[model samples]
Target chain A: MSSRLSLRGFLALSALRTVNSLSRGTGRGSGTVAGGRVGLAIYPKLLNDLSKNRQVILVSGTNGKTTTTALCVAGWGDKVCSNATGANMPAGHVAALSGSSSPHVVLETDEAWLPVALEATNPRVVVLLNLSRDQLDRATEVRSIAERWRSALSKTAHDLVVVANANDPLVVYASESAKNIRWCNIETPWTSDAVSCPKCTQSIVRTSGSWSCVCGFTKPGCVASVSGSEVRIDNETVQTSLSIPGQFNVGNAAMAATALDVLNVDPSKSLTSMKSVTAIAGRFAVRTWQGRKIHMLLAKNPAGFDALLQSLSPGTDDVWIAINARIADGKDPSWLYDVSFEQLRGRKVWCLGERRLDLSTRLDYANVTYEVVNDLNSLPKTSDTTELLANYTAFSDWMQRTTA
Target chain B: MKIALIYPELLGTYGDYGNALALSQRSTRRGIDVDVMNVSITDELPDADLYLLGGGEDGPQRLAADLLKKSSLKQRVANGAHVFAVCAGLQILGTSFCVEGNDAYEGLSLVDVETTRGSVRSVGELLSQVGENKMVGFENHGGVTTLSPGIEPLGTVLHGRGNNGHFDGFVTETIWATYAHGPVLAMNPWLCDEVIAKVTGNNLTPLKTAADQLYAERVTSLSSR
Candidate 1:
């Protein structure tokens, strides 16, 4: 601990620790944000102070931040502190750092809070996964977020290493001005948001594996690339065998490996560490519910849903799609139309959620037959394993209910 | 009945494509044979009895407006095509629309209205009353439109900031434009039926489904809120 802390800062930290213990005893919630808010209210710069003498690594983007952060922490081996339960704002960072005395920390940051978190932690490595439209009601335009990121990264004094996705135009455009960058060719299946270049507003030209624009912007030369289950970094090729299913997870693991590489970690040990991570924050977990096997998936935006759709096994048909329009999930449910629910054309889909009607409406247009079940508990019991894909609040609620 | 979805690539933001889907599903339920055509900006405008346009960002909205102006859309609308346009789509069908921090762009001039940026963005649940029916949906836009004299609105704003924080939408004999973009038609089935009745020139039987119950509940909840 830093001895230069003011008396007020010390008092705030003690209060936060007591509040966190009391909240956990009450068993209301994770107590991460609750304790964090208390601490931050007393000292607004608590995160900066807590993060001092710590080598922080921030993972931020529209999606996959949690999984990537988990993977990065695993690659860093034991004694790595992280916000493991998905409480990822500045308050969450304070709560996470306040608990552990580890000098190394990995954090998953929200998209809009990336600049603020970056300034506070001054991380040695910033891993940016990809940028896409998400929660338009709560978030500003995607281009505006990227512009802010570019402005923030350009002014940093330290030699910050940026692990960026080259395939996403927004990510590429935002991190292009960084001095030291480790680009990853992380393929994005959903290209609707990247149709126009963020810099020039012209249609981007995309080939099979690369994308370019009429202006001077294009996919940067990637030092790390993911091909199927294999990751290529420098001259070493490591076949990732993660318990998590999906190419997106593989891309996330590749980014983790590259981040570890920048920290001079052994490649074999990093890959070994990643293979042990079966689930992160309740995602990609196979659980038995009411004697029926179920696979839980979380998709917040069109790009995430598209990737989840592609990850489905060929013979798998039955699906349950739940959507909600809560403040956490964005009050507007219009993004439902942007998803290609047509991919579920022949599958038996059971739409259930606060906004199941919107999902059913989108499914109807996709020419898919669906049954709307208002009560999730009344869903018909099936012998076979079923896939459950839901948005943010729905997924969180389901996880809480099922686990409880 | 043929319905052409115009510039979906550029104008299909905010789930506006749901409007087209709503039309097709309702038409199929009514035993009416509906042929839906998706027309891109580069493609020639297809002649249809009804046309659908969705909302989009400012740049794509301008591109869609420019393309529609140059294409045969104006001619077809002049020839009595029933057109339903949402947020950006509504702005694009008007005479002119001013973007924030940019010069104003020319619209298709198919509707007797003009659009300007509002002082603040209007984003929330919008409830409008059109005749005996109430339409409920989500509205997220900064554009405030003013209609010319002799032109009537689609409905009266019950809640939320409608066009210029007062009226809801503009409606003429063959054109209807609104900012209520909860895939407006899906949440407002009566408006969907109205569009179909205007385009097909027939009073179709009402077909109710589980979706209706959801819509009714949502309307009640939104109105109460």
Candidate 2:
């Protein structure tokens, strides 16, 4: 068969297959396929074709992958052919590539799946969100993963655009291979455990809520940067002016905008788009339940969870921490110890999930006060306006029902 | 006391260090000083009152087990010293770890559990109802560990699991290993205290401060089933 005919035929088959897969996987009890796999298979070829006209941007992290991906895609508008659905894995990228019609693909690649997905998508630009200790049972060690990413970035010939989280030393070293790296950070006052430098393994000092590495390798105010508050995306400084409010979101938005700029998109347009996108389903999503404002932030790992806890202010009328014993939430919930729940002062937490008791006991040992609720259905029905900070599946179901 | 936190280089999963932290905190509370050492394949193992091992990915666990075999650590385990192993660390504490496709690697046999990589990987919050009480924690082990007879399983299975398919704390005299990943000691302060009691045989009083009182009040309010 001729190459052109084969390409057309392949696209057609992939599109059909994806539709079928999505339908099958849409049901609640269906296994993990969501048209993400086949979509990943088609990404490399489709993205390579766009190389003549535009650059590819790949976003991956334990959290914020979706928000950043959306920001970049919305920023590019007509210029980008993206899967901004927050699917960072291989299949998710393929699905996005297959659906997009633009020249550029703004893809979200999973950290665990980055090596395979990169080989498949081969995007020109890679944006790494902060590296946190997440799913220790399945994912590679943070340092090892970073080292692999550094090696992978070294090999990619594409005009490498490294969008980094400056507060995270691990991510800085991960994207070390990309010489054209632009650092982004969260300048918010929500200070937590992200204070170490990845290079010299030295402590980064935070002055007036803004952190600066004393390593001298980072240029003052120029090389090392901040989130929406300090980093200039388009021309505006990165800040919480966007739809998302968590301290991490500012960094995510900044990184997204930076990636767009690297892709030759006008920084102004990117910033404009950045303001329009909000939180993804699990990452700090807000939903109204029976006239009460329910804030939901997916706390997958200790870092993300720590950020969520740090981002949490003193005035949560009621807090519900929903933990799942599912594999996706880390087969072992032992990492919860690292989470400084001590910050959650005054507000009583409604601990609910298969792991509710587990969390409750941990809170008990830490002397954190919490109430245990086993039923997820009663999450909204319960009084005191509970904030359902649930896991992947539980949160998704809760959102769908509450919204519907 | 210097606590040799084995596999810190590979098995660190945030609060994974909390096991050490809790150990350190409780030890300090009882007027015991601890220097928690992070020893990996690259670093030499240190001496301590306790040797701890936590969970990580299969690759790292295998790598750590291989590295531990080459060290001068056997003398420590044989001396009836305190060793706290969780999940992957527990598996490595066995006579041999049978990971699929790989030959069963010899273990320290600090415990009676025999671990082999299983087709089914267990992950989630582990709640085991042991001895009339439910022990709450997390267990994300990819390998299935079977405890030998005469060994007491750690905790009761309230949700996720217990030791050797049993929802109880697996106890083998001086050695203690379990799938309790919730950094093991963070939620189970009693367990930490018990380990300390066994290791040192010191009647250290555990204080429940205003923090503990507040926690009880909150749980009482929230756990209204």
Candidate 3:
């Protein structure tokens, strides 16, 4: 073993304690990066040490990671510890494991961090959710992320069971290296990123719901599948009464159940536990402002936006759409065109956020009439329910404002 | 007016297909009959006045370049059809470009330029001067292009890297290419007008909408800071 691996002792553990105390002394909040940064600086393999005896469940994807991680933790009630704050990096993983002594752990891992997180955690069940073009400026490309996942899965296939979405070709290509994978057919409407087969470079031919490539990379048999709201597993349908809105959440719940099933957790009980989670990290959360209870839904990328756009009832009150190209969101707001903003036609759309003009331009092209809203105070004070869809930074800004 | 949205499935990364929507609507607003043909990867390129190719990932980009090299996009452009492309679209219209670490693929060769991978990915709000008209759009590309002699650039870079640090894109009477992809035409209505007017052979009245105001606002905001 390497000298670093051999150096495990009270010194490493005490180092974390000292750093945590020192960080607390600095008067920073318990939630920031200081503690985790210090712990990893000393331990190096901090997550590996913390996750030694735990049954770790690492959920990573372009979308649905936070929600799925939340669902899995909710499934176990106080049994599973997780980074529920949407912090999906190494620091977040270290912090989550250090905070709770629960034998079970769930981590919401970023898509790019999957290989590193997988190596560190030695997870029991690794959930590979759908992949799509999200934050392309920073994430680079979805195919590159998939290739990384594939390479990592090839090495660690024997140690873990991968629960992946079969509906997404990119997800399938990434998880094909796994020795054991519970494939789930959770439908995602965005198919722009997966036209070219990830493996053979041949075009993916999707007839009905099934898909296949000429090089024989076809859709695998799904262990569990969600058709609209109904989830089917082992030829039996599970009536999932989710408090969360959108069919995507139903898919998330089904995916969580499938992942939990690997741990011998009752899928039905897991779904029941998931029913209590009305919102995930303020996603789909209703925040009252100016007498309007704005049902805020996060729709940052094209895939996320496509799912949210499906919920827009035709000819409803003015739908509020906000976009920001902050670093957290991709610096390039080009993906706005990939979304069907044309669906917002015949409805008065109120544009908000920093990229409000860019979005207005996009709407103008889609032939969707819109009004640029620079401030929340300018919102109409009608008591009618108003739905607001926003990208990552814009949504986070909204959360910050309301919470503050 | 027919607008061919070329290979959106293969080359539509960064919302590249939005260019077609922008072009079509901008023409329709001016009382022109517009038919936008959503051409997928497997579909044939329809006869159109203007064709748009957007940015794409490496594999799809290479595939799109290969497909277009063999397809009628070259012959169509030769026959007075206009082509507007971005990033990967810009690269694919050139003589050759590199992808997947130095593996060079032959391009459509419609434009006299070549692109090679660079260390720094040029990604930000790019401001440029396109013949007195200031163009504001987001540029996210890694390819540094070298233009052939006498090849005209779309604009001189005022802020971000276009073809390189100094200039933005290649421009001809029949072809317009750039790395700027807030769907180029949507961000710069004047460029769209130039393409539309060139094809229609008629002067267009300056139809101002929220898009134009947004363009003016973007140019002001992107320029001031």
Candidate 4:
């Protein structure tokens, strides 16, 4: 271990391990970050060895990376160790690497820290989730960050195998120098955004739920496509066909399948592992509260919010939009104006949080009916059956309240 | 009365589509039919009176540039279709966008000058002075945009970013592009009406509705954070 690793490190490590063990004490091994004593010193060497042997995969994006990383790790099984705790930054990544004893790691990385992480812990396989504008306060422009990744990968990668969203031409375009590239796509109808032809500047058109460019070029279909027919997601993990809803989830699945395949995992084995895939807590998870099932979907950005809205059953369900002013929540709530609140239709919307008034104003402007609540102290008593859409912090509080 | 919404994917960061939704609903109240045609990499770009592209991550900009290069979308832009490009859209529409030390990505010359993707990204509520009018919106972009000659600048820098001064959006006769993300159009109907008029060339008046009045009251009562 480096100078950073001392008795202090050991104590912290032991504490986390104890917590992990306690969390799993109830049985069912609720899946925590693996490896308890690798230490931060050995991480650089691990990265070096992995790079030399061509055995690392870095997946990063604004949303979906956590679930995608978990799926890839599950697909790799014991072969891959990862930062599964959704710790995506540099220090967190260090903790993840120290906690992993595997030869290869299929890690989920954040955009801002990917460059630094790659330099320190060079990964052979870099899986880039589609980039979306997020947390401009801490994150560089998406393109600038993408260019950094492109440059770093081109320099550090040996036999790079890149898996990208063909629908998101940005990812396709960014992995320009990958020695090998395999494409995955979220079947159309599940996607609201597609790239314009990079060559012609014309908006690429979609036909029958598949994407096609007008210049006589069609992106090769996904090796493993996640279509509505193929996917089976329900209220219960055992009851539902798949784990998560929304087409973006399908894309994440496709990305995971492609990355694991690059690692030489059998398609069928990977598919079977996906059977265990459950929605990450804040991403899209369901909790039964007093006999009523409540589904929580994190709506951080417009695309995420839009996807979450699209995946939800639009009806008379009580909804909540919790707005926070954290740098991560986005400084400005103006983008709420572009969101299609029409999806809510007759659904009740409760705009709550610090930005509640801002959201309420936009809702009013769109003529979308919503009630504003600044604090939960005065929350009206409702039936257990009420469905709620909430902001991230508000949702967290609401989840704690209801779950407890 | 069918309206087409173009390049939504590229410009969808910070809820750019919400602007389109606002436009669609506003038009719907006016009894106009709307079809939001999403032009992706698979199909040819459709011709629409109005075209909107919002801010997004870098990959979208490069891909959008490449796709726009292949399609005759630039020719259409030169032919004078009303275009509303914001943030990343505005950056990608330039002659080229520089990713700091990285190679510059070529852009459609719909607007002159270029953009330098900065290490430090700017994010905050932006208020710019347009003549005597104040344009308020959220500003978030990691690149600096310089306006070339012949392009009409939108407004003077008031708060967040000034044109070419870390926070000004480039403006042309029929095209309005900016880094300001907010219900930019929602707050400023003047710009929305201007785009609508340019696209349709018909001076249609915006009518007052219950939603509109309610929105006005809410705006009047909004407490800034």
Of 2 and 3, the candidate ranking higher by DockQ: 3
lDDT of 1 by residue, A361-394 (tens): 6776677889888676778798877899999999
Give per-residue CA lDDT, model 3, range B1-225, as digits (tens).
888888877888887777787778778888988898888777887899888888888888888887887799889888889888888999998999999887778998888899998888898889999887899888888899999999999999999999889999989979889889747787788888888888788789888866787788888887888
Docking class of 3: medium
Cα lDDT tens digits, model 4, A160-186, are: 677766666546556655666666655
- Flag regions of model 3 displaced more than 4 Å: A1-12, A18-32, A313-315
Q: Write down the C-alpha DockQ for each prediction.
A: 0.50, 0.25, 0.73, 0.32
Q: What's the fnat for candidate 4, on a 0 to 1 scale?
A: 0.54
Model 3 agreement with the true structure over A64-122: per-residue lDDT tens digits: 88888888998877767788777789887877776667789899998888999999989
Docking quality band of candidate 2, CAPRI definitions: acceptable
What is the DockQ ranking, best to worst? 3, 1, 4, 2
Question: What would the TM-scores of all predictions be?
Answer: 0.92, 0.70, 0.95, 0.68
TM-score of chain A of each: 0.95, 0.80, 0.94, 0.77
A69-163, model 2: which lDDT tens digit per residue? 87787777765666554556555554555444456777777887776656655566788886766766666556577778878777766456677
lDDT of 3 at A156: 88
- Pairs clashing within candidate 1: none
Q: B155, model 1: CA deviation in Å?
A: 0.9
DockQ of 1: 0.50
- DockQ comparison, 1 vs 3, better candidate: 3
